[model samples]
Target: MNKRGQFYLVATVIIVSIIAGLAVISNYSYEKTPSKFYPIEQELRIESAKVMDYGIANGKNTNDLMKNFSRDYSINSDSDSSYFVFGKEDNLTLAGYNELNSTTIQINVGLGEQAMNFTKGQFQAFNFSNTGENIKVIISNVSYDFKLNKGQNFYFVVSKNIDGEKYVATNL
Candidate 1:
């Protein structure tokens, strides 16, 4: 090979080696487990209401369960002491396909105090996938109970409305 050709071949080989090394490192460090928080029983109990819904709706309820959730969970701007849950569920079934859509569940809990505001604010990122649709629900800030020296527990719920039929509540 000519001088220029030899230099070009060497450069190409070096570039390929660097790229291959980076690819191997990236694949090795890839995360297999998802990131999440599984609260202790103490903390989980405080948010039992929300937790119950998740268990029941997914047919995980071995115990007798009777809980009602509104389609939308909302709170008043002035006072967060009280909140409202409202929404509609729609179902679509044809042939062997089935889907449910829940629309508009709002949550406004607590007084929106500094701590509550921060805690509840994280609810914006809470979401679920249902029947090929993405449903968003806001958990109220008031749903949390805090204790000194102990980690706080917060509860929240969301639902979506499909075209017409009622969708079952699944997760909180």
Candidate 2:
């Protein structure tokens, strides 16, 4: 009877230890897992792209179009935030990140035949062209100037940067 009781006690201890170990492992994995912000980010990107498409197709004014679109929709959620900025630096770029998927997404809208190179720091530069229409856009407290011409061909350049957790989207 003593041996049987000891065996039962030992078995219970082993089961309890296994349960505790599993709980610890689960907690660790939950902490290490990335957030599920990619779906929301992708939705924002698609909405932004749709807004751009509609604005370009209908020949709407950049400022009014963006303002109206933004009024009806927002890219922010409880866990994430985003903003859309339209700029004319010989081309247009819509860039942001998907934290859940660990990817950086960039969508380029070109209004001219000539290709343009844009760097991260170039977001601060505002050079207005003399010939095309110059317009100002504000998103998340950042302002940009876009020069565009009517009847110009538009191009799209889509790119993705992986491992995007290091990049945080700032309100400004």
Candidate 1 lDDT, 1-172, residue by residue in tens: 5999999999999999999999998888553321122222233334445545565568663122211221112221111221212111122111000112122233222223221122332112221111122222243222322211111122322222334432222223
Give the per-residue lDDT of model 2 (tens digit) for 1-172: 9999999999999999999999998888433333454454565556666776787789876545554454344323433323344435443334322222332222223333222223332121112233345434333234444445453322211122335543233221
Whole-structure CA lDDT of model 1:
0.29
Q: Which stretches of candidate 1 lie over 4 Å from their true place?
A: 29-34, 40-42, 45-172
Model 1 CA RMSD to the hidden true structure, in angstroms: 17.9
Residue 133 of model 1, lDDT score = 25
Clash counts for all predictions? 21, 0
Q: What is the lDDT of residue 160 in candidate 1?
A: 27
